[model samples]
Structures are given as structure tokens and as C-alpha cells.
Target: MTAPTTPAAEALPHQGPAAGTTPLIIRVHGTPAGQGRVSFFGKGRAVHSNHKKLMPWRAAITDAARRELAYAFPADAARLVDGQPVPILLGAIAAEITVTVPKPKSAPKRLTSWPITRTSHDIDHHARAVLDALTHAQVWKDDAQVVEMTIRKVYPGEGIDALDRPGALIRIWPIPTEAVGR
Candidate 1:
């Protein structure tokens, strides 16, 4: 038996979408969530649009993720091809992926950049991991970005902090020091 203080807190989509032929896609909201989208895709764009160079393609992460899921999880052939009805117990079959929008611990006044891409499963998975990383400051890699999330700076603890700090990438640029001084 264990005493409960605060809620256990629901686990975000840690694994692939749900277990089924239908694909699962998850969209996370918050600082890292937004930036992760841009970075992972490796494209710069309008505040809410994805240019061709990017991975997500500007249709909203949910829609983009759904398409990704469709490829990852094609319809069951045994039922559809073999001419058998999907069992009633399973309910209408469609890919089911959940996006988790956790409340922020703190928020930044200004945001600078987000990684262009995660490069794992799809755009959605990377977003969740990137945002989570930004929140926890566990993982950050200064990558040469042709798009978004290409250059990542993950902060550890302290919510609503500098995951989106301005010019964070500019600092990472290869600037030569000790010039014209002595």
C-alpha cells in the first residue's frame, strides 16, 4: 500500500501509437512542442505553416502525424482482403494517437529557436521527446540545421525556462574568438 500525495500524473505517449493496424500519432503542446515541430522538419516557415523544406509540411502536427501513422500502420488485410467483418468487440477501427498538452511550469517571455527534426519514428514522436527534454533539460545536441530542431538546446529542471530563449542558436554559431585584439 502506498500513500498518494498528488496524482501519479499520466504517462505521455512514450511508445508508438496504440496497439493496432491503425497508426497512432501524438501531438504535444507547449514550448518544446512548437519548436520541435519546426526543427525536426528542418524547414523555416510562417508561424503556423510548413514550407516544403520542412518535415511536417505545415498542415498541423495532428494531420501530418496521422499521415505518418497511416504509413506506419496500414489497415488489417485479413479482415478487409479476406472478406471478414472486423469484430464488433474491437469497435470501429481507426488509428488512434493521443496528443498530450501538459500545463507549463513556467513560460518564457521570448522564444528563439527549435530543433528542425527528431529523426526517429515521425514528427509527432520527436515533438513529445523534444518537449519533454526541454522540460527536463536532459538532452540537447547542437546540430548543424538545414531546417528546424536541427540545433537543440535542452534545459534540465525549472519549468517555463530557457528552452526557447532567443538567439540561443546564434551563440552556437562558429564565431572566431581572439581576433584583432592583441
Candidate 2:
């Protein structure tokens, strides 16, 4: 019997980026019960007085994210840059933030999920809270380094086993150095 012949290499489509070229990425899993902090204003228009309580919340979440990153990249986290600890993630970055809230019990019995959150917290507000925390945690050199961002907020839908839980999932990756057009 004749041996089977392989198809020409050119016949196959390029499925993805070349191996070894994938951008460095990190994922920070969040608590199911955490709520994004809200910005508020205090009497006399003092920013510090208005944000005193919120600062602690931001710090706690930032610490959590920092710990996760360090756990995954101890060596990188320990590295020094210009005599200071290096921000493991650097360069232009892209971030995707997905916030999950528990399904609203007040909805009609037949409605398992709402199309969107109608609460006082806007999607941008949630994103800002996280981004600010990330900046504080030094996930990157600065929040300004994030050139692209996508944020979404939704309540648990049907078949989502973790409906009782709520949290945010953050995905961050460095944009290719050459792609920055700097």
C-alpha cells in the first residue's frame, strides 16, 4: 500500500500569533463578596475628608491584587529597577474588568437575570475603583500606561452556579513594545 501523503504546509491557515510572541499576561481573581468602592464628597469640599473611608477599601483591594501577582511572579516582584522595586508589569498595557453581582431577588420569579445593573454604581465607577487600586499596587508603572480598557458589569445569569457570590475578574497584559508607536 502507498504511504499516506501530508497536505502542503501552505494549505493550512495561520491560527494565531507565532509561538513565543504572546504578550506577558496576569490574571487577578477577586473575592465573590467584594464590592467596588464608591467615590464620595464630604462637607466643605475637602477631598481627603470625603475619601478617608474609601482609601482603606482601596488599599485593602490593592494589597490583595498585589499579593496575587507576587504569588505568581515572586522573582519578578523582587527585581529592582533604578534602586527601587520594579513594577513587574510595565509598558503600555490593556485591561479587561468584569464585575459579577448576585442576581436580584426582587426580579419577577421567571426572570433569572437582569440585562444590566440598574444600581447607583456605574460601570465606569467600578472600573475606576479597580484601576486606581491597580495604580496604587503598581501593577504597572502607572494607570496611564493602560492604553486600552474594557469593563462590564452584570448579575449572575441562569446556570451560573455562583449566583450567591459577586466579584470582579481582572485580566491585564502588556502591549507589544513595538506597537506603542512611541
Candidate 3:
């Protein structure tokens, strides 16, 4: 199937260093969900894991990534290799993800800038969900392509931050080929 064309795509240069330098930013507006633990079911002879709790969150992230990618890259820019479509950003990637969760009702009003130390979900679990969603969206070849990642979890209105809503802000930069293995 052919890719869709748009005015924005037509206006952008077909080839340039901009793609490499400019980071793709995606703002997912919703309560961020952490990756759940693997839960096994059935008896010893037939045990299987059920890890579906984060599916909704993952789907949201995938949708947001897809929209951001479409806005950043031309639809026709996709290349074919071995009969499969290749993602625009190839090679290693550096990602910075900021997850903002809602302030707990139990938190004191004066404690607006404090960290969330009592939460059950860890920051790494949230990062995993986002990374997996990006992979599903084909933002890159695989999640393994992410060589550098910085993830932070915070409550809304924390530490001079303007994002008062519960969500995640993801920024992905393509690492230049020459910068790898150094």
C-alpha cells in the first residue's frame, strides 16, 4: 500500500540533516500506567503468563508516537527492505521521558514540589511501557536501538514544572552513526 501525502510532507525537504538533529517530541495526555508484573496461571502442566494490564496505556503511547512521527516525517519517506517498511529514524536513539502523575489526595497542599516516594509503581516500569509502545509504533527498528534513556517520574505541579496534568512527555533524538561505539 502507498503512503498518504500531505501539504506538510510536500513542504519539507526530502533529505537533510534536520531529521537527525531535530528530536521527535510526543505529549501523551492521560494518567501514565506502569508495566505490570508477569502473572502466571493454571497448574504445573499448563502454566501461562497474563500481562495485559498495561495494554491501554501502551496503546495510548503508540497512538501518540504514530501521530508525532507522521507530523515529523513524510508519509512517503518510509523505505522498503525485505518487503517490510522501515522506520524513518534508523540507528541508535537517545530518549528522555518525563512522566507526570496526579498528586495524591493524601499529599499536603504545601508539599507541591516533593517527590513521590511512597508509590508502588517505580519509574523504570513506566519507562518500559513507553519504550515498548514506541517499538510497537515503529518509531525505530526496535526498543534495543535505544542506547541512551533518561526517565523521570513526578507529580503534577512539581518543582516549577508547568505540566500540571497527568501524562508523559517523550523526546527522542537520533544518534549520529559516527557517535556510536565510542
Candidate 4:
């Protein structure tokens, strides 16, 4: 059987050196539920905040996670006055799946046409809530709305930091609304 072609590889954003480009001190957390801490490399950096970790779900449900991880946090954040450092996220890690990719193989003695698999995509999305949480004090309110906002703002596939397995699939959870009984 034939194979599919990959889209043109996109270059990472070139924002110049981190020296003046507004770097954030991001901390990460992985526990009963993955948690993240954002702070500067140094300077006793920290913010008193709490963000939730989403559960891995099915395809349809993935949408809400994107919205929440990408949009909600930014929306819920407190308004920043000025000069206060904006948060910069590294990424999150939680549950994961592994996808293997094919590669040419080379042996210590010789090379062979036989196909060998190399590299794997570490599945992740729930971790995004942390990245999405970073923003000016005012912007990230620590709420689902902020996550939703972030999802809407970032281009698809780009919102989740580069941490998922290459062939990893994603799951989305639906946004909860009021019950019909009221």
C-alpha cells in the first residue's frame, strides 16, 4: 500500500532572543492530577493559582478541551495593570499513548532496506490547561472560560504544546450546560 504525504513542516516562531522578549517562569505539575507551576527561571517566581487537569476523552469531546485549554484560562485571569510579568507556559503531561513511526535502519555492521520504527508521539492535551493558564494577571482568571478562549485563539494542532506522540490521537469533552429539569 502507498503512504500519505506530510504537510510542509512549519518553522517555529522567530521572536528573537529571550533576553527582552518577555520570558515567563513556568512551572509544571504532575500528580493525582497533572498540575503546573509557572514562574521565572529565578527570582522566587510564583503565583497563587489553581487550574484543573482535563481527562483524556474521545474525538468529539476533544473540542471542549481545546477550547478550555486554549481559551478558558486567559478569559478567567485577573486584569494586569502593567509591568507585572506575563505568564509563560512550558507544557503539561498526563496520560499518554505511543505511536511508532517508520524509519530506515542501520546496523553496526551494515545497513538494510528493512523498515525500522523510530520515535513516538507522547499523547497529551490535558496538560494544556496549564499553558493556557499563563497570561497577564488580569487576563488569566483561572476558569473554564479562559481555556475555551485559548482554544479559539490558537490555530488547531498548535494550541497543544509539542509533546504529543507523533501519531497520537486526541479526545475532546463536551462543554457542560445547565440540566434541563430546572
Candidate 2, superposed: residue stretches over 4 Å from native = 1-57, 80-84, 108-112, 115-120, 157-164, 178-182
Error of 2 at 80 (Å): 5.0
What is candidate 2's lDDT per residue for 1-182, written digit by digit as tens? 97665555323433322346443333333432223443456664434322644466467558777787788778887787787767867766777666665556675657555435445255776677678888877777788887778767656544332233455666777766544333
Tens digit of per-residue lDDT, candidate 4, span 1-182: 85654333232222212233332222122221222344454678654223332222222133333344445445423323475533322222112222112222342223322212222111223334333322222223333332221212111123233222212222222222211111
Measured by lDDT, the strongest candidate is 3
Backbone clashes for every candidate come to 23, 1, 0, 46
Which runs of model 3 end up more than 4 angstroms from their true locations? 1-20, 41-53, 76-85, 115-120, 160-162, 180-182
- Tens-digit lDDT track of model 1 for 1-182: 97654433332222322333233223322322333333333455333223242233223443433343345434631233246322211221222222222223353426532333332124454344433322222111211221122223333221233222311111111111222122
**Per-candidate TM-score against the hidden true structure:** 0.18, 0.63, 0.74, 0.21
Worst 10 residues of 3 by lDDT: 44-53
Order the candidates by TM-score, highest first. Answer: 3, 2, 4, 1
After superposition, the stretches of candidate 4 with alpha carbons farther than 4 Å from their true spots are 1-12, 15-19, 30-124, 135-182
Q: What's the distance in Å from true for residue 90, model 1?
A: 4.8
Cand. 1 TM to true fold: 0.18
lDDT of each: 0.28, 0.59, 0.73, 0.27
Candidate 1 total steric clashes: 23
- Which should have the higher lDDT, number 3 or number 4? 3
